[model samples]
Target: MGGLHADHAKPDDRPTGLPTSSATLTPLVVKMLRHGRIAAEHDLLDIGTGAGGLTAIAATRLGSDRVTSVDIDGYLVDAARDRLAGMGLSPHFVTQDATDALPGDYDRIVATVSARPVPVSWLQALRRGGRLVTTIADTALILTAWKTPDGGATGVIERDWAGFMTTRHGSAYPPGLDELFETAREADGENVKLFRYPVTDIRNNWEVWSMLTISIPGIEVDFEETPEGRTAWLAHPDGSWARAEATKFEPPTVHQSGPRRLWSELESIRNWREVEGGLPLYGCRAVVTPDGAIHLSRGRWSATIG
Candidate 1:
């Protein structure tokens, strides 16, 4: 929360040698804390302790002894320890992979970073009836569920759209899909068609971007406004790719290749929004099994992420 500005460092300015930690915005942190339903008597775990901001707030509200913080980055853990110590507050700090065994049972567990599958260890560490608040990776879907008697958890996705950096297990994330991107740049796509809709920058539209992520996981997107108009590219690790270009209020030219029609899929989602007036991602019911599979359902539509 405190280091929100620093966490948003420009991509070009970030050092290539160090893994970056994510800091949550103050407002979002408050929302997560409220959804967690933390109480003064409850024990808490602050996962992904980037800069110790959330840990500090919890310690101040719940006392230092009742809070435990863990992170994979030893460097970040050490820095957070020192920062908390400066305020005359010291909470238990453990430097380890969060997906591994955690230290203590807690009534509340809040993660500031996004996880692919609400980690299984988190469910094991939470007491029955305890709450876990977190977001899914690659999308702005916030989940807050309470552990049930049978080891599964049930809850709903928050209406707000909040995003954080994904968790990592090493010094840095694995290299990007350079080989796939390079091939997609020049490879002749199998299908070329005229796109009837005006070129839209999906990245700038949170709803469309989030829906696209759910519809096509692991897809990468890029956009640029050039003198010719707007150009956009979509690439997937499976060799699927699409390139589109168009000016304001004009239809774009689209070319796609690989096993999937990436642009057409996007257009389908856009058309669905046009018909339904919105997406079914937010405020949906979320159920998590003990094995760490998460399922979200709203009306007749449902999706699973693990």
Candidate 2:
């Protein structure tokens, strides 16, 4: 279950699969494509052409002319194009950042990669009432929205969850939270206390990870098993870091420091979830403002995906 779950690493926060980024799992690909409600007449723009599996399937089902796949890496786009050509499929392929100006009007846009906020550019390129299926960066919430006439979008957080590497503007991603993690690896920290809730394995706990990610964006997670016990580290770009150490059948000792108490924040989210019965991400209705700010609301609970 933990295979591709991630926050910042959304796989990139902790990469897997291909050397560059995690390709959408085949099952998830099929699920998304099906849910995408693709029609033979729909012009589809597939983002993050990793391994080209999704592109191949879409091109096959929708026909190559109806599909346009893009990736930031030219090499990936070129390679995927070649592979598809062998199968007598040639969808339009482009090598550029997905967040940039997307070319062509698309009736359906499905990104295997994640986006922080639904990019405005995407909305601009989408035809009216077009369908878009993508995941929120740093979480596993699959978003399916429709282009609204107001230049925004509205939809829902699908009942299922999936994670893809966050979209990158360049071949290499910007720096990560390495400095804070280095200190967390050893420093005792400015605040040390006992965790009220069980230590969280952000890597594996998809719901909690999604909640925390939505609550506090840019949190990166790392954990390791040692002969002594288990250690989990959470670092944020804002210089906040938390380290928890625990052994089997025992409580964790938490050490945290910085502008925010990362561990306490996680505990708070867990506690809130306990009181609320569960998170509001799944099955929640989402509205992407004309500016691309995604707002979600379900019942009386609400949260925005940044």
Candidate 3:
């Protein structure tokens, strides 16, 4: 029950035995491909060509001659090429760092995994009216923006959230909890009343949280689970805290850490839900500044990106 499970499932559409670029790609990428926009007879660039599955799909839609694929790993490029060759689709594949200057501009650019922040260089790479679709890091931060006549771009968040590996640059990501597990386990905190909230899912929660981060500033959330229970951590750089533990909803027990009562925040959301019904999220409009700030706008609470 903890791991990923699609309750209302759809059949797997990926080719059997293909090297997947990322776990998030399969159904999501295939569904995007089926829409037939990325493949429409236009020149395109596929960044981070993992195993050529997406490249192969792009080639089928846009013709192999019209698509150019780039990857940081030569071996992966070669392997993806081999896979594409077997499919009789020979897209131009190159072993090069996409963070550097990519040769030639095109109508579209898509990256499966991006570790680097969305650099202004990406905006410059687009021809007027071109589009860029990429997931920022591994978070479900999907950016789909179209070029503006003024040389900037605007886009909306994709419906789902995806986590991807960090870019191969400095300041990638903080060490996982495993690295600090001993510290957290040894720390003492106050026991508090258990508060219950129905979390539909984390994937759809980004719009709300993202909007909150922008507005609240320095607010952060962390999640972990163990045999003991499920836990969510809310912390602020200013030293506020909230911790939730759910072993059973009948009367869950929670731990409060730091000055701020963190469970109270979740409780506030839950109380709102009781009166307003479930909140609407997903497909929210996101505006990225030229300087690489992310902003999520829901109805009343707008979260900002630092």
Candidate 4:
């Protein structure tokens, strides 16, 4: 609720304070922390402590003395500090890149940010039975893991959808989108196909599928909107991909391309959709080895990490 813009205050704006999440996902995340059953005495680590809104919640729920928050931006660090102070909560705040190395041992480490392969050092910083929750950017994956005695963690993808700003060691994201799109548009063999998949609404599916895409072959997801229309893409590394466009209705006109027929895969899952039933987008089990291998499952097709 901290640093909430007037426009974002509206119920339709989808506010989560963090980039990839919405207010709707906040309760889910809190539920996850509760299910993990961390002790009241356990230390909590909050990575990418945006405006300290969630940090304040974590402090309240986990105890102020037991929480620590870290961020890469000093400005944000200071701003969040003030916000936390406003709420009369004092959790240690650090201005450092989370991917480097975290300070102190924590029983629950939660990141509202995204990063590359999780560093092995993060595991070292965890006490036994500690847990880590984060979203991956390149693939929009959410990971919730626990530290085991053997140095690996096991958890699950709560949902398959969510996106976060990539962890920045420096200023921010690299400039590559424009060039990449231009290249794709200019390619000579610009053939296109069409289809549709029953994807969980982006607002609610933030954890499971996000992690699944990183390991799956030819399942890249992208979104674009213009005055002309709104569009989404699900591409694969193997050159097979699908595109869905909506100029008016909630349903979109789907287009696809490449050899692997990605839209067909999504349609396979969509055909089984039932009343009050959609493909499992969240609550899928996940396991992360010390070596950084991520595995996700839900009694059907499974996906892995890079």
Whole-model lDDT values for every prediction? 0.84, 0.85, 0.61, 0.63
Between candidates 1 and 4, which one is better according to lDDT? 1
TM-score of 4: 0.70
Tens digit of per-residue lDDT, candidate 2, span 156-197: 999998888878876666667777789999998899988866
- In angstroms, give how far residue 223 of model 4 lies from its true place: 3.9
Q: Of the candidates shown, which would achieve the greatest TM-score relative to the real structure?
A: 2
Give per-residue CA lDDT, model 3, range 106-132, as digits (tens).
888777765434756566777888888
Runs of candidate 3 exceeding 4 Å displacement: 1-25, 34-36, 114-117, 136-138, 160-163, 170-174, 177-181, 190-193, 198-229, 232-243, 258-281
TM-score of each: 0.90, 0.91, 0.71, 0.70
Residue 270 CA error for candidate 2 (Å)? 1.3
**Ranking 2 against 4 by lDDT, winner:** 2
How many pairs collide in each candidate, listed in order?
0, 5, 11, 18
- Model 2: what TM-score? 0.91
Worst 10-residue stretch by lDDT in candidate 3? 1-10
TM-score, cand. 3: 0.71
Tens digit of per-residue lDDT, candidate 1, span 199-283: 7878767778888988788988877787779877888888788888788658888889889999999998888888999999889
Worst-scoring 10-residue span by lDDT in model 1: 1-10
Ranking by lDDT: 2, 1, 4, 3
Cα-based lDDT at residue 253, candidate 1: 82
